[model samples]
Target: MSQQPPAQQQSHPGETGQMQPRPRDEMADYTGRDLLADKKALVSGGDSGIGRAVCAAFAKEGADVAIGYLSEDSDAEHTAELVRRQNRRSLQIRGDVADEQHCHDMVDKTVREFGRIDVLVVHAATQEPVSDFTELSTEQLRRTYEVNVFGAFWTVRAAAPHLAPDASIVITGSVNGLRGNKTLIDYATSKAAVHNLTYSLAQHYMQDGIRVNCVAPGPVWTPLIPSTLGEEKVEGFGEQAPMGRAADPDEIAPSYVFFASNRLSSYYTGEVLAPTGGEIQAG
Candidate 1:
């Protein structure tokens, strides 16, 4: 993929088909080695972007997947088709992850379809940029936390009972969570909470033989960029990174794959694999 310039989308939660230059989110060229053979997985926000890539990768790795999305029926259907093409069962569930009941229902539905969950990828997130801290409203902050932080909590809690031994849970974090972004105060804060949640859950679940980890990515060219950052910011979206370009979802999905496959990451737990395009940060 080539470098992308500033692009704008009129809607929040932008459609993948409308993205210019298109995000490399389908993982079309990725080949799997059956690392997750016969596993059952659940991916939140699996309709597009990182979630879509992860679902495809998991399917290619031989895991049947259940995808949870807010709406985006077309995207969801398309993703399901992609999984089916890989010869894996794909279940699509639609609802707001911020709703605790919806989270429980999603887990129940997945269990009903797949019998058990061997991997859980909590990848659904929402963000709205604020130029200054003062411009961030109470409602906006609440919504951000609800979707980015609380949603992960609800889904994990609801799925905990049904998770098989050695199950892997991967949460999506952000570079902004590690280093504050001036324009994304609320979103950064919410993701920071998710980062800590991953650590805490790792410790709490270790006794159950479940491993929890996080992938904190730098700027990635996903729908969230144009829909949230608007035209000016989107043009130079990832120039600040050492790579000078936002990562494709294709570039990030492998981290989830590594974490999901116990064969690959059995000894890893409570770790945040930061794929920030060489933007170094202090621990």
Candidate 2:
């Protein structure tokens, strides 16, 4: 147990610096192949959780990453330092992903820093508690859409113009998109939109050689769980999943790698990789 209660500090992506047990960002045994060598990529919410893992992985793979996060400056700076230690550059920016101006500026700043964009990982999301549909407030629905739907829209729209033909996009969805969790009606519906968004963008952009896809992860061990539910509920998170264990962030980052790498997944697009630990049935 941590000395401090899990501080409910409002934070942005990649901000695991303040968590009791800092999120296991890079796996001890993992090695890299320079797959993303010389590439410049962007990761939203890259200060912590799955986004933080992605940033570390990108660094190991020889890419300088731009981390776009919310308000967690300390966490974002820590993530940047870790990336720099891996001999790759890290640009940490703090802003709301829901802002269209910030969305455009994120891409602009990345291009200014790195000259061009090679990959865009849309991973930041907004979620709220909802028990019943009748109880859903219009503000809640709109805010959810702004963060989940419009956020992806603006990031991609901003980055699209500068990307090379072989650019890749990996949007983050949720397993709830697969099985509608009633309590997450708004959040789940937003994820569903991302699922469809990936396909639409993949089809429309295939001719341009830019692949768009999504990864839907099950109940992984992340702050989102503990922050939403108290510390007690966090323990049994993955008991229901077939694997009977919550995914570590590293376990989830590989899907992004598979999607981002041209050597491994060049022929793939409009795809959904469910890292849900056998929760999805075999086709």
Candidate 3:
């Protein structure tokens, strides 16, 4: 297992370079078998962390990529470089996924550049920890839900028309969604909604030959951890996991690739794959 340093905090919407023990998001050693040959993919929050890894993985599998993020131009450019290194076209779209118009624009720009979208990975999310449930403010709750829940809805809806048959939709859920988290109340609730949305959308689009699925991960060493969880929680981040350490973004990425590839997950729809360091939860 990989080792992570003690906790370090950053401002909201953290940068990957600012993170200590930088997350292994490059997908360096992964080899692909053209599972997504010539496919076009749009990934929200694709600038860093799990999204960055997923973009690289998709590119390695022969898919061109379009990344949408709030700002993070540098990180987005870097991710695009990685995709280009794999000889795939990369389009970088900057805007907040929480904005409905921005979501529509993201889809329009991506489709214009890539011709079509074969995979849509809604990985962008935001969270603010409230030490106590009562400490959660109305604004914080709304912001969290806006980005984590509604953002997914707006993004998917905007992209839905452009997605062709056999297209795949992958949503990033969390272990916190399956079971409540005392500290991450708003974040957990949003993710829970996303999980159910994945199920509902799977049924809604099944007739169109579209597949929807989710990957609910446990503690992952991403910029989101320190940025949202704070110093103390970051220090021993994944110790509670049976694996004793948070997973690297590189480690969590393959689950996305699996769901994105029809050759691998043809019969799977509305499924939640938990890569949670041995943590178990009932359905």
- Residue 79 deviation, candidate 3, in Å? 0.6
For this target, which candidate reaches the highest lDDT against the unseen true structure?
Answer: 3
> lDDT per residue, candidate 2, 1-283, as tens digits?
1122343433323235445555566644568898888999999878777888888888888899999988877767877887898899889888988899999999999999999988899998877666568898999899889989999999999999999889999999999887777877999999999999999999999999999999999977666665565445555566678887677788899889889999889999999999898886343
lDDT tens digits, residue span 14-71, model 3 = 8899987888999999999999999999999999999999999999999999999888
Q: Candidate 3, after superposition: displacement of residue 187 in Å?
A: 0.5
Candidate 2: stretches off by over 4 Å = 1-22, 230-232
List residue ranges in candidate 3 displaced over 4 A.
none
* Clash count per candidate: 2, 6, 1
lDDT of residue 216 for candidate 3 = 97
lDDT of each: 0.92, 0.83, 0.93
Cα lDDT tens digits for candidate 1, 1-283 = 4766555664888788888768899899999999999999999999998899999999999999999999889989999999999999999999999899999999999999999999999999999988778999999999999999999999999999999998999999999999988989998888899999999999999999999999999988887777787688887778888988889999999999999999999999999999999999899
All candidates' TM-scores?
A: 0.98, 0.92, 0.98
Taking all chains together, the TM-score of candidate 3 against the true structure is 0.98
**TM-score of candidate 1 to 2 decimals:** 0.98
TM-score of 2: 0.92
